[model samples]
Target: MDLCLFVTHNCPLGCSYCYSTPKMDVNMTLETAKKSVDFALSHSHDEFQLSFFGGEPLLMWDLMQKATAYAREKCSEKSIPPVFTVTTNGVLLDEEKCKWLKDQEFHIAVSIDGNDRMHDCCRTYPDGSSSHDDSVRGAKIVQAYYEKFELVSVVTPENVNYLYEGVEYLIKEGFTDITLNPDFYSEWNEAQLDNWTEQFKLIGNLYIDCFRNNSPVRISFIDSKIITHLKNGYEQCDKCRFGLDEMAVAPSGNIYPCERLVGNDTGEHIIGDIYNGFDVQRMVEIKNGNGFASNEECLECELAPRCMNWCHCVNIALTGDMNTTDGIVCFHEKMTIEIADYVGGVLFSEKNPAFMARFYGLR
Candidate 1:
């Protein structure tokens, strides 16, 4: 299900790390929006999702209203309604916008790091001051308006040191759900993994704290990992939602599985033109692991089944092969697995009291 009818490419803030390669350089038009919704319903996807992302989504706020209404009407015609999600920088979110999102019951993800210093380093405006203050304000309004919204912090080396502080701040801000991602807008290298470990370790501790405090906020990383550990699946993802062959439509009506994959840096993955119709069979092939991608070092990892080689975007960035079999991952599955094992021994089996003493690999 192409849950993303990627609305536009034009954004107000010029973030240095923005990774946008438009299928066509255009703004969202009402007719194109209608056609996109029609395309989704045509597939009879049953339950559909429409997510608004952008250079900055609010830049096209008026267009979004029209598209949202049209999507609803299209779904009605197909005897199915659409669920909406928006990922925004929060520069433009205000009282009225929040009311509309709440009224529509859209799932929203706001972008912000812990404090001003961290937030500005990765996300900024043309003048390059920092969007931290405004983003925080917008996040507040959005959270009040949309109960299910979340905050996504783009992790950078500079901000990596502050992961604990950011987590504490987000929890205190009343946002229970958060996504802390490595800042991919920059180049990938070995140096970044150390930062990721620090962040993940903090997150693991946060889960322990959550358990102790009876926190209702869902920590995606640890909670999902726990679920996967219990179910014999992925550490965070139960099933590869992207593996299901989801698509992202650009402003000009071109379709691809995800925005990250749609970058001009690699355009062969763009399946079809939305103006016509998506190649359903082609899409199925890609979704089912039949698509062409180069798998690099991942070809040797033992954790392939669980991690599925991590994400395609991350793999390409790290190893230059979007299709690496077990290409390195963000959370460091090896580390997480070790942590999970240690957690089991310490928290479950007092039979292994020497756990901390055993970061050393046993003979």
Candidate 2:
């Protein structure tokens, strides 16, 4: 099981496309944190991950420490090793914090859009000052302490042209695990979409070249798709055990299906709370409700079997209707599958047998 603790709804940066409403000023109390941890621990059997999430989880540093300590104690008693992780914008990271994070064995994911100009375009301070330098500095500190960490960059229409540049910058910065995610909910015009497709193909070629030469590179978007293609001809939504295997806890102790569904106001999405436990029936309804029965486009498409439709949260965000699929998101999904199939076929057949070993880290 994976339990995400939304430590707080407070953030220092004012990224233009931020999904969380950081102005709400909601912080998870220690009492609520303890209860949420206890609830998750009790339900977990062998191993479980405790992910610290938020508008900026580091803002509630004190609460995070307490919760982690409590979780560690409980897990020790239960004889289960605890796995911890945090996803942050990298503004508040310091040497001390980096040391503590490394000591705790927390898998950190830092948000950096790309180069200075591209990153500073939207990731700015509340006063509209540039956050590029500070963010890079923080990332460097974390990297110095922890050899492995994920660099997560969001790609919007405005920055679509910089896709290759952004990834190149992360590679130069010594990051091996990188993820460039397109903002599916953002309005993408023809020009932006065209640019994104071209850049994506260029990046795919670069990945193949790197693999052939045995260079360290792992782009999550492309790599995940390739892995899915190799294992199963396509991906399926039911394989995503969100409400069952993973859950997100809000500041008020309310439990949600996932992190994306945390701040959403819809009452139907709230499966259960720490005080009451999971609503198994509601969870089943959510999982069963995510198939192609509702989306006519998916039902008729050739990729339906291998497709994982826009997640319910993304669907609601883009269309204001959870049951509906967004045209733009669907377009990106189809393109991704097509590209993954092509890339996987080329690498599997033409490349050296060691290519898969190197790509998958068995080498």
Candidate 3:
């Protein structure tokens, strides 16, 4: 089981496509955090992932440290191994923080959209000043401590044209693992979608070139598609089982299936709270109400096996109905699969050593 604690609702930066907008000055209580950990451990059999998330989780540094200590103690008592991770906007990540995170063996993900021009398009400070430099500096600092930290890049329509260059720049800056996210709520016209496809193709070419040059990297969007193809469809892990394998706890103690759904800590869509325990009936309703099998169009579609249409959080966030499929997600999956197959085909045909070794287990 994976448990995420929304430690704080205060952020220093004002990102353009931020889902947690209208940020508040709220923080989670240390007692609530410990109880959240205990609640998550009750669901896990052997291992658990405890992650810190927020408007800026690093803002509540003391809470994070205490919560981690409490979780570690609990896990030790329960004989379960606990894994830790944190996703940060990267502005507040300094040397001391990085060193502590490294000592704790926390899996870190730094948010850096791309280069300065591409990044500053959406991620900026309160005064609208450039946060690009600070973000990049933090990423570099994290990289110095951990060789395999994740670099999360959110692609918006404004910076869609720079997708290929953005990824290439990250690779040049020594980031090996990258995840690209699209602002699904943003307006995307046909032209922009077409450009998105082209940019991905350029990225595909870059991916092949990297492997050929002996410096292979992992791009989450592309790697997932290729791996899904290898498996012939989306695996069990690929699909989201809302409130089942993973859950999030808001600063107010309201429980949600995903962190993205915890907007403003509103009581809407809350399954339960730390004090009340999970609403079993409501949880069943939510889990049963969503899936590709529920939608007739998805049932009839040929790509149903590999499509991510069953993600309830994404569907609800974009269309307000978990059962309905959004055109944006449909289009994104199709384009990504097409590009991934193309890239996979080229590398497979050439028998790229690194690709073969990584995917095919060929020594």
Candidate 4:
């Protein structure tokens, strides 16, 4: 089971596409955090992940520290080693924090849009000042301490054209693992969609070139799809595993299916509270009514097997209906799958023996 603990909904960066309700000054208490951890440990049989999430989890550093200590102690008592991860905006990270996180072996994910202009356009300080430089510096510090970390860059129509450039910038900055995701809920017009498709193709070609040259970078969005296809023939439902095997606990101990639905007003996404435990029936209903199950159009589409459709949370955010598929998101997914197929063909061809050997770990 994967437990995403929304430690706090308070953040310093004013990201334009931020989905969290950051105005609420909510922070998870140590007591609530411990209970949440206990709930996860009890429910999960063998292994479970404890993910620290927030408007910026680092904002509640003290609470985070306490929660980590408590979780470690409880996991030790239960004879289970805990897995830790943190997703942050990387604004408040310092040398000390970086070293501590490295020592603790936390899988860190830093949010940065791309280059300064693209990142600062959306991710800025409350005072409207740029946070790009500081965020990059933080990423550098974390990378210096830990060899493996992920850079998550959000792509909006405003910055979609610069997708390749942003990825290249991260690579130049010594980041090997990168994820570029579109602002799923944003309204993308025809031109933006076309541009996004072209940019994706360009990135795919670049990725292939890098692999051919023996210097491979992992672009999570594309690489994951390719890997999944190779492993299972196609991508499955891109649903948020909320309510099912995954759960997101708010600071107030309210349970949600995922963090994106943490502040939803409809109340339908709230399965149960940590104290009361998950309502099994509600969880069943959620799984039964997941995005893949509800969208008949998606099921019938040729790309359904490999397409990375929006999750329920993103579908709800984009179309105001969990079952409805966003046209732009659907288009982007198809484009991404097509590009992945092309890259797979190139990498697996007999002509590219060296690349294939390297890609398959034979090298």
lDDT of each: 0.66, 0.80, 0.89, 0.80
Q: What TM value does model 4 have?
A: 0.92
Model 2: clashing residue pairs? Answer: 235-306
Candidate 1 ranges with C-alpha deviation above 4 Å? 21-25, 184-192, 235-245, 264-268, 279-302, 308-310, 316-322, 325-331, 337-363
TM-scores for the candidates: 0.82, 0.90, 0.97, 0.92
The lDDT of model 1 is 0.66
Give lDDT: candidate 1, residue 265: 27
lDDT of 2 by residue, 290-321 (tens): 54425777768876555556466777667766
Best by lDDT: 3
Give per-residue lDDT, candidate 4, residue 256. 86
Model 4 lDDT per residue over 1-363, tens place: 688899887898878888774556778888999899998888887777889997899998998888888888888887888899999989899999988887777999999988887787788887889999989988988888887889999989888878878877888787888898778777788898888888888888888887777677888767866765776534343445656768889887888888778862236578899899888887776766764524678878866656555476777677766667777667777777788888878888744655566456665
**lDDT score of residue 264 within candidate 4:** 28
Clashes of 1: 4
Clashing pairs in 1: 11-55, 295-324, 298-326, 298-327
* lDDT tens digits, residue span 25-52, model 1: 4576778777877776676557777888
**CA lDDT, candidate 4, residue 35:** 93
Better of 1 and 3 by lDDT: 3
**Candidate 2's C-alpha lDDT?**
0.80
Please give the clash total of every predicted structure, in order: 4, 1, 0, 1
